[model samples]
Target: MPFRSPYPDVEIPDVTLYDLLFTSLTEEDLERPLTIDGSSGAETSYAELRDQVNAIAGALAARGVGQGDVVALHSPNSPAFVATFHGILRAGGTATTVGAMATGKEIATQLEDSGARLLMTVSPLLDAVREAAALVGLADDKIIVLDGADAFESLTDLIAENRPAPEVSVDPSTDLAVLPYSSGTTGRPKGVMLTHRNLVANVAQAAELLGVRRDDNLLAVLPFYHIYGMTVLLNLAILKRASLVTMPRFDLPEFLRIIQDRRCNFVFIAPPIAVALAKHPLVDEFDLSVVSSVFSGGAPLDGEVGGAVARRLGCSVRQGYGMTEMSPVSQLIPAGRDDIPLASVGVTVPNMECMLQDPATREEIPVPESGVSAPGELCCKGPNVMPGYLNNPEATSLTIDDDGWLHTGDIGTVSAEGVVTLIDRLKELIKYKGYQVAPAELESTLLTHELIADAAVIAGYDTEGEEVPKAFVVLQEGAQLTEQEVMDFVAARVAPYKKVRQVVMIEAIPKSASGKILRKELRGA
Candidate 1:
């Protein structure tokens, strides 16, 4: 039997992403500042954003972009990104958001895979964009720069055309709204086809739990290209009528300064930022008294780190769990709920059904009557789940089952109280002498060490040619510790099999834009 969300289900509107977020705006709502550039302190009012969206859509439509067409948006977080994203959807064109840090080959791969007809990017990234555009045989006319570049039309040029957005009939249930590529940490990047309903349903499902109000100013430090930021920070904030202070990239001093300067009340971050907030000395330099809540996602946040942040900032620190395939959020610690354990991802959002099944036996692991259930692959079924992976039915079939359950490829347990605790990725677990050792469990233990600033754990073969837990550690600034000392620390905290058998001190852990450890890169190295 599957466990349903503890919260009451909310009604999801049958409408396009554009209509769901913009249609109900009143005159007063239009006057509100929706997007603020943290770097330059530039602002975009709801009215200006809407007008820009309309003009961009009209320009794209004039270039033959419409239903069933794909347009790639490759840019960092900016006020212009917000308008261009919605503008692509408004034209009934699926927006395929590419990571800003993606290499030319990676960007080209996404452009070719998504069959993107047009490429939208900024001047700073033109070199990579040009390489990608050329590889995909995209003409110069098909490339639009958000900020002006030589020989390329800018966002202002399109908006200045002053054309009205063409009205297009959209079937919210079936029309693909945005196609964000999966992180591709474990495998090749695949386009996750999300419909308008998928995005709208997730926003509605998460509305109450997130509790982002119109008066709140959300710090958009997380990249908007990632689903975590795209849905949670970008879409949800807009739907709630809150303002977003956009940051192009994460810079600790600047991130703290913006929070203090903008008086941003809500902050959405990844585990890496949480580590900085809890441990970085620069954090003490900023007066972040205005921030009321800090939410973390993209990767699992350690309980001890989360607690440290909550105590230091005097704000609620919570964590959520989701993937790009699920519109990015399915479980989150609801706002104002302190009773839920910091280690847990909290109850599932409304309209979601979750289950745990043994990876080897494929037997259902029922929720324990008393304490936490046995760990298994956490599977979810909900309206927010993607219908399938774009152009990859075999891969989709492998991920989502016949009964609609999306196998998350994550190992976790469900408590009798409905709280979900993630263990680790099923494929990332280390097998030592028939025992499964979760790297996340060991990594979390390593983070508690005072000398360790950040860490990542993976499976490595020992002298005996047996798989063992290996740790890549980043020591705190000016701190030094031997490999033996690191191993001994984790050995005392975790089980013998879960101990760090090997330790390699590195300057920093390679991470994705969303802050997930790039284990594949480490493995390749």
Candidate 2:
């Protein structure tokens, strides 16, 4: 039998993303700071954000971008990103957010795959954006530089038009809102099709659990392109009417500076940042006493690391578990619950059902009467779950089953009290500093090298105990390549996080009869 969420279900509104977030704002909420740009100390109040969103939506509508259209947002965390993202959704266009660190080729692949009609990016990334836009046949006029650039239209120009936002009808249950790419089970990245209801339901399910107060200053260091940051940091904050202090990127001194200067009370971090907070000497230099809680996600947070940070900062430290296909949050340690184990991802959110099933036998593993249940794939069914992957029904069928349970390729055990603890991953994807690094994507890139005959990649632990992509390469006859050379070659081609960290020269890459790389054999070796 499936284990249901202990909390009572929350009512999810039947409305579009814009209406769900913007419509409920009161006069006091409108006057509050919605987004604060950490770099420039510029703030966008709720009223200003709404106006900017409307202006951008109106301009986008004027350009014929409406229902069923896709616009790719490629930029770091900023006030403009928040407005433009909502603007796209308000205009009934699906927003496909691309990572700021993505290479031109990577961006181009996403642009083409998502069928994005327009590209929005910052001036600093104009070179890569131009390359990607050109590859996808996007004309110069199709690109909207968020920050002003030479020979390009800026967000300021759009707002200057002062056109009224078109009244667009959206079916929340069916209309796509955001298309975030994820490497599900095993493969290169595919866009996860999250509907307006998917996101709205997730926010409603997680709102009480997250405990983000309206007065809380939430730090937004995590990249908003990823679902964890998109839903949790951006959407959830906006819905709750909290003040968001945006960090463009992670810099130790700068991150601490913003928290200290802005007096941010809550922070959402990945495991890597938690590690730094736990042991880094620089952390002691800043006064982080204002932080009431620190929530970690994207990758597993070590119990000791969480404990260390909790002790060091004197704040509540918690973690959660989910994927892009599930609006990125299935289980979270409810706010103010210090009783739950730090290693556990806590109980399932409201309106969700979870089950443990043996991967090999496909037998349901019932919850143990006492202690913890046996490790199995943690499958979940919920309104927050994505309907399917974009344009890939086969992949969708493989992920979400006939009965609606989405097989989250993670091995976890649930306690009798409903506390869930993750053990290991059954998937082939690597979590490097909380970023998904697909092995197949790296292997294909490696095979493209002239001297590389074959390659296989697997999750390997670094000296710091962080998971990284370690590649096993079979060079061509009489060819030689250094580990750094291989790493450098991949570094030049892919994002910095996806670069092959460790390379092992091998005679052959082990494979099964079907020619699939035996990743388990590599992991074992």
| Model 1 poorest ten-residue lDDT run | 516-525
In candidate 2, which residue pairs get closer than 3 Å at backbone N, Cα or C atoms, i.e. clash?
none
Q: Candidate 2: count the clashes.
A: 0
Model 1 lDDT tens row, 57-105: 9998998998979999999999999999999999999999999998898
Q: lDDT tens string, model 2, 191-274?
A: 999999999999999998999999989999988888888999899999889989999888889999999999999998986577
Candidate 2: segments with Cα more than 4 A from true spot: 183-186, 428-525
For this target, which candidate reaches the highest lDDT against the unseen true structure? 1
> 208 in model 2: Cα distance from truth in Å?
0.6
In model 1, the runs with Cα more than 4 Å from the true position are none
TM-score of each: 0.99, 0.83
Best by TM-score: 1
Error of 1 at 252 (Å): 0.6
